[model samples]
Each structure stands twice: as C-alpha cells, then as structure tokens.
Target: MSQVRTKVILYNPKAVFYTMPLALIALASYLDKGIYDVKIIDGRLEKDPLMKILDSCEGAVCFAVSVLTGAPIKDALEMTIEVKKRFPELNIVWGGWHPSLFPLETLKETPVDVVVRGQGEIAFEQILTAIINGQSFQGIAGVSYKDKVTGEIVQNAERNMVDINSFPAFNYDFVPVNSYEKLSGRNQIDYIASQGCRFRCNFCADPFMYKRGWYGYAPTRIADELETLWDKYHFEHVHFQDETFFTIGARVEAIAEEFIKRKFRFSWFGTMRADQGSRLPDEVFAKCKASGLERVMIGLESGSQRMIDWMKKDIKIPQVYESAQKCLKHGIAINFSVIIGFPGETEADMDETIRVVTDLRKMSPEFRVSIFYFKPYPGNEIADALIADGYKMPQGIKEWSDFDYVVKGSPWIPEKKFREIENFKFFQRLAWSKPSLLKTPIQTLAKWRIKNKSYHLPIERKLIELIFDRQKLS
Candidate 1:
C-alpha cells in the first residue's frame, strides 16, 4: 500500500506584468515528487484566486507565496491573511526578494510563519522535510522562523549559493503556457538562464542580494532545456530574464552555437551592459544575430561621466556609443534605459543625460530610449547611505506597497524638475516614435519642440491628455 503524500500549495500574487512565476515553479520542481503533491495558483490568472487558495489550503502541509518588493505585497498580504484566518494551523511561508531582504521584519509583523531568505531550492526542501517530520527548523540554513514554543524568531545562518545545474530544469507544466501567451500577447517564453549579478551598481539591490556573485547553467544544459520546452510549448520567442546575459562572452557564443546547431526556430531577447557590449567581438555578435537574437536591453543609466562614476555604473560615456553602434550594425533592436533625478544631481547633470538620450535616439529607428526617475530601494549602497543619514524607510508593508518603479515623482526631485522631466518624457516619446499616418504632423512638431527646448504653452500635451481622459471615460 502506498503512503499518503503531503500536499503543498504555491501561490503567485497579482502584479503589473504577466511574466511566469519561475521562482515558485523552481521550488515546486525541486521538491520530491514521490512524497509531495504540489498545487500552484497564480492570482493574476484567476478570477477568484482567494477562493482557489483557500480551497487548496485544506490538508496541505504548507501554503507558500513568492513575493516581490512593491504593489504585489498588498495582494499577497490580503490573501495570506484570509488563509491564516481559516486555517490557523497551516504553515504560511513567504519567499522572494522582499522576504529575503527583511526576514525578521516579515516574520514579526506578517502572518508568514517562515521566511526563506536566498537561493531557496535547497533550503525550501529542507524546510518541508522538517515540517513533515514535525521537527524544529533550528538548523535549516537561509531560513528565519518563529519558534513555536519560545515565540521568538530564529534566524538561520546564510545559505551558500548552489550551482543551479545541480537542480532540475523548470517544469513549465506547473502553469498554463498558453494563458501567459495570451496575457502577454506574444508567443514568448520567459526564461532565466542564470542567477545573481556580479555588478555593484550603487543604486541597484542585486549586489546585496547576490553578494556580487553570478552563476549560470552550462550552455549545453540551457540549450537542451530550451529545446525540450520549445518542443512542448512551441513558443516563437524566448525572453531570457537574466540580469546580464552577456556576462561571459565565451558562454554566450557557445549558447548561440548550440541554438544554431539545434536549429531552434525562436528569436530571443536579453540584456547587456554597455561595457560588455563594447567588448564583445563582431564575430560573436554575428553568431548571436544568426541564432535569432532580436533585441537587447542595455542599462545606460546616465550620460554624465561624473554621475555614472557616482552611481558606480563603471561604463564610460564612449562605451555607450560604441555599444549602440555595434547593435545597430548587427541589425538588433536596442532598448537603452536611462535614469535621472539621482540625489545631488544638478540641472547640468540632467542635461547631459538628455543629450546622450537624444544622441542615441538619433542612432536608429530600431533603437528605443526609456527614461525613469530614480527611486531609492533598500539593500543598496545609496539607500543604506540615506538610511544612515536618517532617511526613514517604509515602516511596514503598507508603506512599501507605494514603492513602485514606474511611478513618477521622487523625493529628491523638486516639483519644477519633476514636471520638466515628465514633459520631456512625453515629448521624447513623440519626437522619436515611428511616424504614423495620422500623427506625422504632431511628430514633426514634437521633434521641433525638443530641438528648440520649447515646452512652454504645451497645447499638444493638453489636448492629448484630454483625449486620453475622454477615451478612458468612454
């Protein structure tokens, strides 16, 4: 007779993007299938996600949720609260960036019984084993939990990052690939070929989270998994969500060769640093483009060399131009993201950034420029400095929910500067956008306005806003 297997429910909270919850899938795929029955319910995909979650909680060993740092926290909190109310004995676990950053704070304030800090596959498996044996979670590395008897949160020693190749590839069977395809309106698969970033950009949290370490699956392994997944899903594109896809030029070349040799019929997108792109050989770029490389995102944070150094971006201004030329030559679409409004940044600094953005925009119609205001996120050198100087972070989850990257306005930016940036962002979009039959005249006017630095008496902006508002109402 077979023994009864324990049930585990993994949930993904609602968020702005429709990307697949690979973190939950990774954990689910790593668990022992013989002793556990796992159920994954994504809030974004469900109409009655709360009902589904509560239903799945019954007879489950634990209900786990993967969380991010911003708006998703609000929904995750609401769902977890209801689960805790109905099934008080069920272990509610939280993992992902937010919990990994503030494990003790999460355990103390929220209903989460355990917080899995970093590199959760091995640690999470150990956690489940402890739960099944009714044993203490005293020695589970990378875990923080409240002692059931003592009622004190016990923080475990940090877990060493393990080689991802040691684990099984993600099982896309955990979620409906078609649903994501429909949601994103693209025949694309979101994949992560690596974990952690080796960069130490002061404004980025990656360095703290990954400790300036990086690891990737073997090229053969990545190609093998992608081919298998393609055979199953038939996706036309693979969006590699790696932080730095071209970190190792040799590995990138090998991966491209593998894809070419396998005759994979899918285009791919990934990210690169300006320095990395500038250093890549023309032959490697040719190999990648031949392997269906459609686009690459390069983070050109600032045009001002002084500001770039201050941010520790480590890429010179000339490197940005070189990277752009290389991508343009390869006929690859490039999205260059720029950030303004850093603390202590002057008007001159902002002007320099705009200058670079404008120059890059002129490089090619295939090149795209995205402008954003800097938001201070914790666990980064900049945020730590601000905190050290008495810049209070959000007190709880409610405050943190407001920390969104896409939102306009930053505390450091004055109202006048903020409005100017907002106006420039709008006009910049119109100035460089592909000319539509109906909007060519407006695009021409936008280009003239940008060239002349004439934003005052912005009738076009007013009219556009009115039309948008009317459309929303209609």
Candidate 2:
C-alpha cells in the first residue's frame, strides 16, 4: 500500500498582527477536499520550527521574498535551503509583494523552487493540484519558476483576484486568538473587504500593483462575512485590511449604516489617506465610531514643503495639520505614521517636523505616533531615480536593519545627520516641555528609550543606552 503524502505550508513576517497570511491559504483549503491532508504553520504566533516545517511537508510555500519588506530574504532563503538540504525531494514555493515585484531576482538568490506572485488564491490551489498529479508548473498563471529542461526563466502573467468574496473569510482557528490579541491590541481577527488601491503615491506600489485601479467587495458580502465571524467565532472586533478604507465613502457609509441598523457596534480599525479626514466631519466620525471605527492610521510623509513636493504625495503640510486636527476634535483615536527624511530637507525641515509632533501631542495624551524612515519601493519614481543615480542605502551602525536602512535622497542632510535628527535628542525637547505625566519623546526614540512600555525590551534598552551614551559624551 502506498502512503499518503501530506501538503504543508508555512507563512512568516507580518507588519501587523491584525491579519494573517495563513488565512489566505486556509481559504484555499476550503476548496480542497483534504485529499492531501493540508496543514499550516503560522510564524506570527512565534517563529515556526524550521526543521519541523521542512520535514513535515511534502510541499510548501512562503510569502514576500523580494523587496525591502523582504530585506531579510537571505534568512528566509537559508530556511528553504535547509529544508531542501534535509528533504532533497521536497517542493518549495514563495509568494506575496516581494515575489510580485522581483520574481527573477528571487529565483537566483533563494532556493525557492517556485513562486506565486500577486493574488494566489486560485493559483495556489492549482499548484497543489498539479503537483499532486505529477505535472510541471509550465502553465500556472501568476506563478514563476525555473524551467529545468529549458534552463530559462519562466513566468506567467500576473492574475489579480477581483472577486474577493470568492475567498473564504480569514480564519483564526489555525492561530490562537490570544497570541493575535496580544500583538494587535484586539481579540478579533481581520479580513480584506477590498483588494488593491487606486492612489498614485510615488513611494507605494499599490497603484502600480493594480495598474492604478481599486477593487472592493460588495457591502452585503462583507456584512455577511463579518456577521459569520461575529456569530460563529463570537468575535466582538474587526480590522479591515483595506489600503484606503474610505476610498469610496459610500461603501464605508453603507457598511457603517448596516452596523447601526443591526446594532453591531464592533471595534474596528483601518488605514486611510489623510486628506479625506477633512471631508468627513465630526458627524461622520461619530457615526463611524458608534459603528466601531476605533482607530485610523494616516501617513504624513513629511512636514517639510520641499520634502512633500519631492515625493509627489499630492497632499500638503496644511492638509496634514487640518486633517489631524479634525480627527482629534471628533474623538476618533488617531495613529499617525510620519516620514522624516526625503530629498533635499534642511535643518528647518527637521525642525518643522518637531513642531508638528509637538502640536499633535498637545491635542491628546492618548494619541499614538509611529515614526518611520523613508523608503523608496520598487516601480516608484523616487526608487527609479535613485537607482539611476547610484544611490546606496545606509544600514544603521548601532541599530542594525530596519525601515531606517533606506537613506533619504535629500542632498543637504547626510545619512548620519538624518539618523541624529531621528535620535533621542530630537524627542527630549518636546517630552521635557510638559512636566505632567512625564512626557514621552515626540521623536519616539530619542536615540534613547521610548516611553511606550509596549515596545520590545531590547529596542527600549538599546534606545536608552544610545541616548544616554550620547548625552554623556556631550
């Protein structure tokens, strides 16, 4: 009697614990009849046991192995190599944003036997079915793999998943709810009511990914999925994984109105463009909050006029403050992500940023500020220009790799100076301003420890040590 071979897959690396990549694969599992005994390893809960991941499965797939987001690709590749080292006959694959952008480079650098780029819902299922039948991946759509016989790069045209409803709701059964709850500050899981984005921000690939088109799910369908999650899992919160959640206000209004009608006041959060906040007044925010829009993340690329124009962000500094003020007044908790360095920023530019963070803090003590280094993603105007001009990304000396690795293109500010601006001193000025409650730094990490005990201990220690060391030297 022949033994049945089980299919195993592993996913790792998430920016937010609100959503899981394994959920997408599990959706594929629903279409499957369990003929192959499918299994999943969620890296978000904790790092997966690599040897076990390799030894346990006949075939497997990983996500995001190409761009800056996949900066630690060498580590990801090494894992696959280890798997192949142990099981010479095992099949390995890669997927997500990194693969979608640089499939060719990924094939060369990693032991990724195959890659599924873009939306891999149907494509993933097809790959498993084909491998089970002992077929080659020559004709798989949205997949790229080596042509062993031809010794050439073989890639299929990108296939975008338009019917998001066709995909099953994100499942938490595979991942412990406690683990996710601990990381994301909510007990509920999330789903994509929409896919792709329409904005043409030069630094982001959303517009590039969808050919500048945005796709959304039906309101009824979305409501049905959320209702199922609430009804079945007894979940009381949700996170919508939409790039610009209120891109079409009507869709959002419809969803919010449905919640009001059903009395489903579930806590939820979503990302949105900053300018839109000005248009949505206090009444709209009250409605959203009542229906459960607890938090919103807005990206303020920079406070400097010159820096803002260079990135072609379209939105201006005044708009940022206005939008921020509106959100604050409305009682809608705001989580801001600010970009510090960009092309041609001066001391004045950095100071302007200090001013913005200072004012925003005055509005509320509960407001959260997330500071990030500027990055030039692929297919972006800035990235293309930089690569054309022989720009080198700087990895921080003390802090190792992070979003800070990408040195901004500003000619006036050296990478070190930019790092200094982001360091502890910049934050101390603002934090020391108010003696009440012992203010945390406006810059987040003052080259020193940030006040948020929620942050990792190592990061906190390093930041504190770095800032203190710098202070002692001064």
Candidate 3:
C-alpha cells in the first residue's frame, strides 16, 4: 500500500451531550504527529443522509467512540462489530464514560479491541499507532486492551491529565462550514475551557472521571480560539461545554475581556452551579452578558433540601433566590434545570421545586424550567445499586435521560400521576418534543406567571397556569 490513513473517531452529533470537543483535541494531535492519517466526524447535530461513517475511514487501525452521547451505545458497538466483520484488519474500540468503567464487559460483548479507561487522547493515539506500526502496547498509560496472544484485558498505568496547552485550538476543517449552518440554523460550535468538576454529586459521573483535580484551558487561548473560529469558519455561536462556567469566575471574566478585546463575541450558553451564580458579582454578570452570554443554565437538582443533602448537592434555598436576582439583573436569561423523582422524593419536595421555578419566572419573562427525571447513567454512582435492587425499567431506559424519551419513560415516574399536572410525557408525545411546547411557551406564559412579578424569586408557589388552566377549561 502506498499510504494508509487508519484512525477515526465518531461523535454522535445528535446527542444531548455536546462535549465532543475533547475528542477533537485528541484527533488534532494524531493529525499533527503525521504518524497516522486521522479523520473525525461529529454525527451529532449533523443531518448527514447516508451512513458514510464506517466506510469513511478504511483499514482504520482503531476507531474512537464517544459514549457521552448515550444514544449510540448499542448502535456504535454494533457498528464496531460490523466494521470488524467487514474489515478484518481493523480494530474497533470504545471509550468515554460508558466503556471506561465496563472495559472487560464491553470488549467481550462487542467488536471493541480496546477500551481507554481514562482520558483517550494520547493513549488512544499511542495504542493505534503501535497497532499500525506492528509494535507492542504493553506500557501505554490509560489503556485497557486485550493481548492478541493471551486475549486477556490489560489496563496500563493511569494517565495523568492533560495540560490544556498540549493541544491546539479546535480546527474544524474536517467539518464543512456549511454543516454547522445546516444543522443548527446558526453557526453553532461547542468548546470546553475545563476538564473536571470539583464536587462529587452522587447523581453524576464526574466523580469517577476527574477524581479531584481542577483543569482549565488558557484564557487567551480560548479567546483566540473564538476569534479563529469566527475568522476561519464564520461561526456565529458557541455552546461552552464547561461543567461549570462560573466555577472559576475569574477565568470567565478574563474570557469575557478577551472576547470584548477581540470583537469576536457571539451568542453563547453554558451551565453553572447555583452557588456560583449567587456569588457571581453583578459586574462579572454584566461582562458575561455584554460578551454575548445570552443564556445560562443552572443545575438546581432538587427543591428539597433533604434531597440536596442526600445527593451532596450542597445548595441552599437562599442561593437559588439570589442567583435568580443576579441573572435577571444582568439581563442573562436563566434556564433552571430541576431533577425530580430521586429515591427520597416527596410531595413537599416537588411542591418546593414548582415554587422556585415559578418565582424565577416572575423575576423575568425569559426564565424557563427544564425538569428532568432522575437517571442512572451507565457510570453514575447510583447505577450499580439500582441494577442490584432488581428495579426493572422499561426498554426506553436508554433514552430516559433525554427529554424526547420522557413520554415513554414517564410511565415509570408515577403510573397515574403525570397525565394530569406535570405530564411531560403527554407533551413529549403530542408535540414530538417540539421546543414550542416543552419549555418556551409553557414555562413563561402559561406556567410561570402564576405569582405577581417581583424581585423576590418564588420557589414553592404557582408561577404559571398552562396545564391547570387547560384542565379547568376541560
């Protein structure tokens, strides 16, 4: 063969998880080294008609599957098997949260030849190039691989986390500029300024991934990346995938300054904690908004202090209220994310959450509530316990975390309850998960305005009247 390019990574662009830029970081390294020909495709958010993913990279020594998307676990694994069956020379691999914890199970069950139990950027690159060069991968850090001779899984020593500067700014040349426009109706791209979370929320997978170190990209580099995207790709919007944009409020302020300096600011969104929002100064909030941070999502998790205590969320009722005031005053729209139906849920908890959402709405007409059912993602701390408790879930459990799957998954919530008041499933099915019905019109107009408009954020009162009004009419 004259030359062979034998590595690729597939990101399910349609996934609710929009954090594939990390994988892109690793792919960029492979391309720069010139040791292998590498290509990456974000299948998420893309409207690619043909299934050209597997066929795109031939004799691919290895493929990296992004598991955070959660939609493609079964299909991505199946595709790996199919690729292996068709191309006998190729090695299929799986990574990210889904495969990392279940290395042996995933490897044996699927066509996956390798699993990167930790960060994959370097480990995957090293392992793939070795496989291509017909070399040994005995000591590569952060890899779980089956020995060709023994067929036993070998997990190498742990890989230290990456410094942000080790990688280049995201180069989207692999993606057509038109693709972003076509998919989002805006030039939407995602970037991350950080790698790990500080807290150990029982309901999340961060505790398993990051352990306890704080990692972040350089501020100037991030600002530069934004400018580069704007200059090169004509990208007009960004959704920062940072776990908490305000965790390092200073860094966020620096980023805003850079954006203001560069004149490349675009409408952006990111998630932050309630505590961060409350502590965030009005000046910083103003800078964020002026820098085009139009929307900020807060993970309130629960209205019940009991539930918060149990999940170790470390939030206070007052923090929620203060955060609302800060967001509203700064002209930044708030999308409050609430999680209900954890193990210790009661009527009062639900009542309090409804109250908080309603009060936030009165503070500003732009406030919206995004209520989600408690999910035990594959690697979440609760998954093992729940699976052991013999709690049988319906087949739709795969998509239960997704709002679109809420209709089918809702039956598990309260068999007779959701149909009347908080029937997310009804709207999910009737409206086909349309945005018009899910959060926008229903939250601000019909559901949230139940209380008088005021500076005080209400957390346990009727704020809007969408579902109840319809019921009254009926």
Displacement of residue 147 (Cα, Å) in model 3 is 1.4
Indicate the TM-score of model 1.
0.96
Each prediction's total of clashing residue pairs, residues at least 3 apart in sequence or on different chains, is 0, 7, 19
Q: Which candidate number has the best TM-score? A: 1
* CA lDDT scores, all candidates in order: 0.89, 0.62, 0.65
TM-score of 2: 0.79
lDDT by residue for model 2 (1-474), tens: 766544555545334334555434444445444454555555445555575466555444322222224344434555667777876656677776656666776676666668877766677777777777778887888899876567577887777655666666655555565666667666676666777777777777766556666678777777776887677666667877778887877777787877877788578888877677766666777778778878888877666777767677677777777777767776677777777656556778877765676566556644556655665556567777777788764322111124334454345567665555555333433343334343343234432343432223346445545766533321
Q: Cα RMSD for candidate 3?
A: 6.6
Per-residue lDDT of model 1, residues 59-88, tens digit only: 998999998998888899999999999999
Off by over 4 Å in 1: 436-438, 465-474
List the candidate 3 regions with Cα displacement exceeding 4 Å: 1-22, 42-54, 387-417, 420-474
Angstrom error at residue 315, model 1 = 1.0
TM-score for each prediction? 0.96, 0.79, 0.82
Q: After superposition, how far is residue 360 of candidate 2 from its true place, in Å?
A: 2.4
Ranking by TM-score: 1, 3, 2
